[model samples]
Target chain A: MEAPERLGEVVQASTDRFTAQCYRLYGAPPLGSLVRAGEREPHVYGIVSSVTTSSLDPTRPVVARGASEPTEEAIYRSNPQLERLLRTDFEAMTVGHTQDGTIHQYLAPLPPHIHAFVFRCTPDEVRAFTQRLDFLPLLVGARTPPGDEVLAACLREAASAHDQPTEFLVQAGRKLALLLGGEMQRLNTILRRLPL
Target chain B: MTGREESPEVLGPQLLGVVVGGSLSQGLEVRLEDGGVVEELKVGTFVTIRGERHRFFGMVTDLGLASADPRLPSALPDTTNPAIVRILSGTSAYATMQVTPSLVVGGEETSLLLEGPQPARSIPFHFSRAYRASQEDVQAVFGAEDERHIWIGSPLDMEDTRVCLDLAEFVKRSNGVFGKSGTGKSFLTRILLAGILQRDVAVNLVFDMHSEYGWEGGSEEGHAVKGLKQLFGSRVAVFSLDEESSRRRGLSPDYLVRIGYDQIEPQDIETLAEMLNLTQNAAQATYKLASRHGQQWLREFLALEGREELAALADQLGEHQQTIESLRRRLDRLNRMAFLVERSPEDSVRRILEYLDRGTHVVLEFGRYGSDLSAYLLVANLLTRRIHDSYVRRKEQSLGDRAKEPRPLVITIEEAHRFLNPQVAGLTIFGTIAREMRKYNVTLLVVDQRPSGIDEEVLSQVGTRITCLLDNERDIEAVLTGASGARELRQVLARLEPKQQALIFGHALPMPVVVRTREYGPRTYAEFGFREQAELAREAEKDLKDLFG
Candidate 1:
C-alpha cells in the first residue's frame, strides 16, 4: 500500500510499451519476472528482459583500477567512491495492463507515464496473472536473441516469489519444456540456466 | 424484449477462458480464468469468444496444461498429491486451450453458413472472455427443429444436448457411414434408417448384405437391433434372395425375390471380377460370351463344356483356352446356387421395384448370400441396374403432379467399398446411382469399414458422412478429403471415442459436429417413436374390420 518501496521508474513511454530504469540497490528483478508501474486508472505490467549496471552520468569517465588488495571485496570496500559512480537499471518488456480490479493480458491502450513508479509484482498478483502460460510466446519470441535466457531468469524469479514456488516452478518448467519441446538444445539451455 | 418468455437470457454459456493470442487460421489460444482448472474442459468442447460486434464460436482442438515458469525443471513434477494439486491450482500453473473458431454469430444481421471467420482477418478482441457456449448459442448454431430434424445423437460435450441432422438435406444427397469393425457403424445406420422412416421423406431400399437390418439385426455387442421392417411393418417390405433359408431361419420375408441366370449381366460379372479375382483374359471372355449369346451369356458359356469346343471359341476370340475353360468351371458354381434361378423367376426385380414405387421401403435380406462376395455382387448389381434404370426414366419423364410423383429413393448397401472401387466404379450400377443420384431422386447410404477402397469420385460425391473411429490413415484421408469442413474436421475426426462416438459432417447439418451416437438397444427402440407407424397399420386393420362388420 505504501508503494512497496519503488524498485525503479519509467524512463520512456509509448502507446502500449514502456521501459523503466531500476534503482541502483539490490540486484534488479530477474529477467521474465513481472514488474508493475503506472498508477490511478491504468496500471501497466511488464516482464523484465534485461538488467544493466553503468555510470549514472555517462559524461563522467568512471573506471575501476586494479588495487593492490588481498580480496576483490576489500578493494571494493576500500574504494567506496566507486559505488556512487554507477547504478543498476533493469528493463522490462510490456506484456499487459490491469485496471479497475480486472486484468487484461494484452497491451494497454496507454503506456506507463514517464517517470512512473516501478515495483516488483506482488506474489498474489503473480499467482493470479500466471494462471495460464499464454504469455510465454511474447518473451520467448522476443526480437532479442537472448529472450530465452531472459524468460528463464524471469520464470525462476516468479517461482521463488510465491510461497509454494517449487511446485509452481516445476509445473512452469514442464510447460516451458513443452513449448520448447521441438528445440531440445534450446530447452536444455533454458532449463540449465534457470534461477531455481 | 426483456420481459417476454420467448426472449430468454441473451448471455451465452458460463465464462470459461479469455482469448490471449493465437493465429486466426490455425486457431486461437485461450487462458483459463481464476479457479478454472484445465481438467474441467475436455477436448472437443465448444467455447465462444465475444468479439467487438460478433460472437466467435470455437471447438477445442488441443489443451495446454503446464508450468507457467520455464525455469522449472524439464522433468514433469508429480502433482498427484492434494498439496501438489493445491500448488497446481494457482497462477504459476499454465492452463490454456487451442480452439479453432468455426462459426461467427450475433451481429447486426445474423446468418449461419459453413464458412468460418478468416484467420487474422477479424481477430477477436484480445483478452476478451470466452465462455462455455450457452444453450442459446448452441440452439442458434445447431437448431434443426424446423427442418425434418432427425435427432441422431447427443454431443460428446453435453449429454442432454441432442445433435440433430436435417433429414431433408440428408436425403437429398448420397451419404455414407464408415468406421472400423465394432465401431457401431451399423447402429448409426439403423438409427439413421429409423429417422428416414419416421420422416418418410424418402423411400429406402437397403441391400442388407449381412441380414442384420431386416427383421432383427446382429449388433456390435452381438445384441439384437430390431430392424426397420419391425418398426415400419406395413411401410417397410422385406425380400430375401434365399427365401428358403430365410424361412428356415424363421425370417418371414415379404417376398422371396430370386434372380435367374439370364439376369446375370456381363457388366454384373465384370463388377464382380475384382472380388472374384478373375484374370484379365477370363474377364474379357465374359464380354465375348455376351456378344455371341445376347441374353443367355452365363448359361451358354457354361454349356460349352468341352475342352475342344471351348478351345475353338477361345482361339477365335484370341483368349487362353484353359482360362475360358476355368471360367466355365467358375460359372458352373452358380448353377448349384439355390437363389440363382436356372430358369428366371417371374419378374422378381419388377416386384421389388413395385414395392419401392408404392412409397414403401425395401430391405433385401441376403441370408447365406451375405458372406459370398460373388453372389452378393452378382445379385446386388443385377437388381440395382433394373431399379435405377426405371427410376431414372420415371424421374426424367415425370411432368407436374406432386402427390402422385415417384418418391425420392435411398439405396443403402454395406461393404460398399468393394462395389464402388475404382476398378468397378465405371461399370457398377451403384456407381452410376452414386453419381446422378440427386437428379434421379436416388441417393445411397453406403456403409463400409474401408472407405479408402471406394472410388475417390464416389467418396467425394457422398453428401453427409457419419464416420466412427478408424485407425487406418488412408480410410481417414478418404473420408476427410474434398469435404468443405476437411481442415477443422480433421481434429474432430481424430478425437472420436472408439466405441459409440462419431463425427457427422457434410450436407446434413450446418457444421461438422462430434456426437456420442444415440442409443439403439431393443429397450430404447420403442421409445424412439419407431413403433408409431406399426401402430398405425394396426389401427388401419381395425378400421377395415369395423367397416366390413
Candidate 2:
C-alpha cells in the first residue's frame, strides 16, 4: 500500500479502537460522541503505557490503548489480540478496571507519537480521563506530534489525580504540556518539509 | 600767456591733435567758448565751472572728447602743477587732504574735502596738546575722583603721582622704614607715622634708636608727640640705657626661668654657666636644677658654691668653653651696659619675672650705652622672654577654653639680625617664634636692613615681609625668597629709589607697591625738643663766646 493510504487506515483503526475501549471502560460513549452532539471536539481518553520508536520513521506506527475498568478484568482477558499487540509494541504498560465493570488497557509505541497526542488533548479532557481511571501509565521515551499530545494529556490527568493540590505537580504538568507541544511542532515541521 | 616759448602756455580747455603719418598729433588748439585760456591746474586747488566747485587733484593721463557736433568747444583745462597732478599716477594724496577722486566721473558731486590738522609726533603735558591723557585715561590710571583708598597728589596726572596705601589694609600688617645713613630713611619714617596715626584705627609702637622721636613729645620740636601719648596712654614704656634704669629692668636669671628655661638646650645653659664662671657640670646641674627648683634654685646653688668650683665647671665645658665664656662675659657686660646694679643671679631673675608679668612695649635705648653686642642680646632676650610668657599664658587660656578667645600679639624686633644669628646655638628663640607663635596668635615682625644676616630657616617661615630699600643683592635675594610674587617684587625693588621707595611684598600687601613713609607723631617720643647731650656742650661754648663778646 502507498504510505498515505496506510497512514489513513492506521488513524481510522486507532480512532475506532479508542472509541470502543473508552465506551467499555467508562460505560459511556467515546469522547467523540460529545463532539458529534456539538458539546466538544473529539478527544482521546487513554493511559500512557510505553513510548518507543523514532519520530523520523514514517513506517513506524504510533500506538496507544484506552484505559480499562477494574470490573471488566474478564473483558481484557477476552481481548487477547489487543493485549498481545500492546505487549509487543509498548515499552511500558498500564491496565485500568473502572467501577462500571469495564476493562481497559493502554499501549503506546513511539514516545513522539504519545507526546503529540497528549499535546492535542485539553486540560478538561485529561482531567475527565483521570477521573474515570485508577492507575496511569508513565511514558518511557521521547515521541513526536500526536504522541507528544497524548503524553501532555496523561501528565495533566496524573496531576489531577493527586489528593492534594500541589504547586509542584501543577508546574510539572505545565512544563510537560509545553515540551509535548514543542516536540509536536518540531515533528510536524520536519514531516511537512519531506520531499514526498 | 606770457610767451610762445613755453608751448603757448597751454591755452584753451581742449587740445586738438592731428593725425600725421601713422600717428594722430595735435591738429589745432581749441579755445574756451568764454574766450579765455586755462591758466594753472593745481590738484588740491578748488575751481569753479558752471557754478559748481570741482577740485583739481588728479592727473590727466589721457584726455579726449567725442561729440557729433563739431561746433561744440573741445578746449580742455591745463594740468601742470606737481602739487595738483600726480605725474607717476600712483602717488597718494597727503593724509591732511580730504579729496580723493575716481577716474570715471558719473555726475556725482564730489564732497567738500576740507583738510584736517595733522597728527603731532609727540604728546605734550597740557590737555590742549595731543600728548595730554584723555579723560578716560585719567580715570583708568588714577581711578575715579571719589575713590576712598587712592590719594591723588597735586599735578596728579603727572608721573610724579603718589598713591598712599589704603590705611585699612596697611595697618593689618605693620609697615617698616629702612635705608642707609643720610638716605632720609628717618625722615620718611616720621612722615609715614604721621599719616598712619591720623587714622582712627591706627596704633603704633615706634622703637626710637637715635632719640630723634623721643624729644618730639616734650619740650621738643617734633609735632603730634602729645597725640601719640594720648593714643597709646600707659601701653608704651620707654627704657633708657641710663645706668640705673638698665640695671633695674635688664634680662635677669629669673626671667629665663619664667620664660621656661626647661625648653632651652644645654648648650645655652653652658654658655650661661661660663658667663657666670660656673663649672660645666655646675651649668648642666644648674639648668637641670633650675628646671626642677625654678629660678630660686639657681640663686641658692650659686650662693653655696665657691668661685674655684665655678671656674672648674666652666673649664670642664672643654670644646664649648670659649662659647660658654663668651656668653658669661656677655651677661656680665649686659649688667654693666644696662646700668643695672650687679646683684645675685636670683635677684636679677626675679626682676625679669616681674617685668614680664606686666605687658608693656619696652623700648631699650642702647645708644647712650654705646654699641654693645651683649647689651643688645640681653635686651632682646629680656623682651623675647616677656613676649614668650604672655603668649604662653594666653595660649594656655585659649586651650583651656577650647580656643574660644584668641589674643593676637605681634613682637616687632628692631635691628633683628643682631639677635637672630644662625651661628648661635641658643638662637632657637627666633625659630621657635616663627614656627610656634602663630598658634598662640604671636607673630614676629623682624626689622633689619640685611635680611640675609638672619637664619634662612627663620626667614623662610616669615609669612609677611616688608622690604625697604635693600641695597645688597644678598639681602634682596633673601627678601625675594620670603616674599610672595617674587618677580613683580624684584621689578619693584630694582626701581626703588632711596628713602621713600620701598617694595612692600608679602601676604599683607595686595601687590608690592613703592610707597613713601609717613612722618612720626611728636607724642611717640617722651623727651621732645631736647638736643643731643653731645651737642649741648658745643652749644654752651658758642653761647658763652657770644655772651662775652
Residue B292, model 1, lDDT: 80
Candidate 1: tens digits of C-alpha lDDT, residues A1-196: 3234468788877754467776664458766788888655588888887777878799986665656788878877887877777777877777778878787777788788888988887777787777665667667667687778778777777776666766666566656655664554565567666544
Local distance difference test, per candidate? Answer: 0.76, 0.36
TM-scores for the candidates: 0.71, 0.39
lDDT of 2: 0.36
Q: In model 1, state the lDDT of residue B17.
A: 70
B252 Cα displacement, candidate 1 (Å)? 2.1
Predicted structure with the largest lDDT when compared to the true one: 1
State residue B319's C-alpha deviation in candidate 2, in Å.
8.9
C-alpha DockQ of every model:
0.04, 0.00
Docking class of 1: incorrect
